[model samples]
Target: MLELNDISYMAGNRTILQGISFNVRKGELLMVSGPSGSGKSTLLRIIGDQLSPASGSIRLNGRSILEYRPEEYRQKVSYVFQTPTLFMDTVIEDLEFPYRIRSAAPDMERIRELLPEVGLTEEILQKESRVISGGEKQRVALLRSLLIAPDILLLDEVTASLDRENARMIENTVKCLSARGMTIIWVTHDPDQLELSDRVLRIRDGKVVESIA
Candidate 1:
């Protein structure tokens, strides 16, 4: 479980999040829904430990995330952005990048199986990541993030750039993962995403106004 207590953030003179508090249960899909600039992305970043809250405590699994080693904590909690960012040239390289970073053995067979599950064919594995469509890249990014089997997944408008077909493909994979008990926290303005969530949090000016669970 992840818990945020009286979390607040400030940038220069402006306050972004004010006493934000929430608890995300294990295996629950928590959807943060609100207009742009409502601090959804910031909240995710805070939870992911990319950004620190000015005042508050963020606890993961009954302990503060700050107490864990950075790499170990990151492996347990993965964050995916709106756009697919790849470091390597090819699709396969990008998928295998995480394990490489951690010096872990590459599970080739598992990766190959995941590729098809994410709607990518074997032929495209050798191709440059830049050549793939935005949707394919996003799927690849997601696979890369899941290489270490993160306990918590934080996604920011993951399907915002994909077409309906591609979006659904990603959605299906996400739903399948959620069904298998992954902790998914996503930020979106899409009603469909809200409808699919186990819990919905509505934000206004960085404060949670209502929770539809």
Candidate 2:
């Protein structure tokens, strides 16, 4: 469903990514692992179109990503950062923001069903977003992303800040999504996360060194 061909990126004299190439098939969970400064997140940003590759190209469904409208492309391929950002005062308002932007009604029932999967209750939605724990906030951010129904999810260390239990909940939720056929490209340092991946790619100094399937 997604392809990266000879992708490379640089920052001044430093190289961040070099000739990185990989393909993520539909419904596959691909885990990207590397040491700090190895450019895993940069790779994801390129795929999400938040950053353009210095050389090479990214394609989705056989079409160049540059060919799609920015907003339309992002709706089909969403990116969730390591830290959750909720600008709204209330959880419901935050959850409803996406729908509000699209001029569509919020799907309260679906939202309610999604809460428990991430270890949250519907009552929490009525509370202030600022009062929620980091884990809860991350879950909320995740749910908000999923609500948009993106075909591919680009996750950048999303569970890095959460406690073990909360991380497990997020992991389970991601696995469930993959089972339901959502293509996932997850960047994680946790070894436990590797167990859930359909394939694992390791990078060193901006180049793919090993790929385990």
Candidate 3:
């Protein structure tokens, strides 16, 4: 569903990604594993169009990503950062914001259902977002992203900081999404996460190597 051809990026004189290329099939769960500063996140940012590649191109559905409007592209390809940002006063407000932007009413029932799936409760949604723990905040951010039902989900170490239980919750939730045909590109260092992937690519020094399926 998505293809990256000879992708490269640079930060001033430093290279971030060099000659990176990969294809993520529809409904496939692809795991990107590498040490810090290996360009996994950069690869994701490029795919999400947050960073322009210095060379090469990204295609979604056989069309260049540049062909789609920025807002429209982002809606279809969602990126969840490792450290989730919640600027809203309450969790519910954060969750409702996406629907509000589309000028549609919030789906309360779906929100309620999703909350527990991510190890959160309905009551927590009423609490102040700033007061929540990091894990809770991450879960809320994840739920907010899923509320939009993006076609491709780019997860950047989303469960890196969560406890085992919470991480499992997220893994299972993502597996369910994959089962439903959502393309997932997950960046994680955890070996368990690697074990669950349909394909794994190891990146180092901005290069892709040691791919397994």
Which 10-residue window in model 2 sums to the lowest lDDT?
Answer: 113-122
Each model's C-alpha lDDT? 0.90, 0.92, 0.90
Ranking by TM-score: 1, 2, 3
lDDT of 1 at 165: 94
Model 2 gets an lDDT of 0.92
Q: Which pairs in model 2 have colliding backbones?
A: none
User: Tens digit of lDDT per residue, candidate 2, span 1-213?
Assistant: 898999999888899999999899999999999999999999989998999888998889999998999988989999999999997999999999989988999999889888887778888988999999998999999999988889999899999988998898899999899989889999999988999999999988999999999
Write down the TM-score of every candidate. 0.97, 0.97, 0.95
What is the Å distance of residue 27 in model 2 from its true position? 0.2
Among these predictions, the greatest lDDT belongs to 2
Candidate 3 colliding pairs: none
CA displacement after TM-score superposition, residue 27 of candidate 3 (Å): 0.5
The sequence of per-residue lDDT tens digits that candidate 1 reaches over residues 1-213 is 999999999999999999999999999999999888989999999999899999999999999988999998999999999998988999888878888887877888888878876777888889998898899889888988887889999999999988999989988888888999999999987788787789999999989999998
- In model 3, state the lDDT of residue 154: 93
- Using TM-score as the yardstick, the better of models 1 and 3 is 1
